[model samples]
Target: MKKRTHTRLASIVGLFIIASIGLYFILSNLEDNIVFFYPPSDIEKITNAKTKIRVGGLVKENSVVILSANKIRFTITDYKNTLIIEYTGILPALFREKQGIVAEGTFVNGVFEAKNLLAKHDENYMPPEVVKTLVK
Candidate 1:
């Protein structure tokens, strides 16, 4: 009976360790996939180059510069600080001056190299994150 109990306890401990390892892996992957959101004013606080982040603000007036090769450079501002974003490929229909938008990418060399843009807002509608930052 003593030997049987020992074996059962060992099996349980082994299963517990396996479960802990699996859980750790799952949580780590989820953390890696999470893209954090930040306002333009707070952009200077981002220090991690490997992590992707989203920046939300209004398009700075007359800051859109169409570049060659389907690339475009623009500025975003929360009326306090501004961030420059460079994106390649077609832009969204709602992309315009004074409009609110969010761009997701890595901040490199003092510029945000956007890989994705979220500007699907309609008239009289803006993203909650943008509103929150601008309202302050």
Candidate 2:
């Protein structure tokens, strides 16, 4: 009975150790993969050139240049600030000037290189933060 109890305790402790190690690995990976979202103004302050991130703001009115009806260049503004975005993919149907947008990419050579762009949909909906900025 004593030997059996000892074996059970050892098995429980081994399982606990394995679980702890697994938890640590998952948490570490989560930290490494986490990406931050910022507005144009926030992106301007970033200095880590290699870190991937996202920018969200309102597309500037009349700033869009449809290079080929597919490739597009535009500026996203946080009212007092703006960032130029270049993308060469099929833009979402909702993409337009003066609308809310979020772009995931890197900033290099004084431009935001967008890998993906998401445009706001519908007149009744605007990103809450952007609307608040516009109201102020």
Candidate 3:
């Protein structure tokens, strides 16, 4: 009976260790991949450049500047604050001043370097996340 109980406890501990390791790996990967969204007003609170994040707001009026055939710079505003974004790609057809937009990338040296840009699909469609945080 003593030998049997020792074996059962060992088995339970072994299983617990394996499960703990698996849970750790899953949470770690999710931490690296999870991107949090922020509005322009709250962007300054983030200082980590290595972590990817999303910024959503309306394009500021007369802020879009075409730097080259593919590179463009613009400012996004949340009615409280503004942040500049630099993207090197063709913007969507619906991309225009005062339109809702979201950019995913990292903020570096006071500018948001965009890896992806999402424009509103239509005149009436806006991201639910944007609407929740936007003043209007």
Report lDDT per candidate. 0.86, 0.83, 0.87
lDDT-superior candidate, 1 or 3: 3
What's the best-to-worst order under TM-score?
Answer: 2, 3, 1
Q: Report the lDDT tens digits of candidate 1 across residue range 7-104.
A: 99999999999999999999998873464568887776767875788888999999999988789999999999888999987888889999888898
Q: 1-136 in candidate 3: lDDT tens per residue?
A: 6999999999999999999999999999897346556889877677677778888999999999999999999999999999999998888878999988989988777789999999866567777798988966
Off by over 4 Å in 1: 1-36, 120-136
Worst 10 residues of 3 by lDDT: 29-38
State which candidate, 2 or 3, has the greater TM-score: 2
User: In terms of TM-score, which candidate is stronger, 1 or 2?
Assistant: 2
lDDT of 2 by residue, 9-102 (tens): 9999999999999999999988634544688777756768666778889999889987786688899989878899888888888888878898
Count clashes in each candidate, considering only residues at least 3 apart in sequence or on different chains: 0, 0, 0
Clashing pairs in 2: none
Once model 2 is optimally superposed onto the true structure by TM-score, how far is the C-alpha of residue 89 displaced, in angstroms? 2.3
Choose 1 or 2, whichever is better by lDDT. 1
Query: Judged by lDDT against the true structure, how good is candidate 1?
Result: 0.86
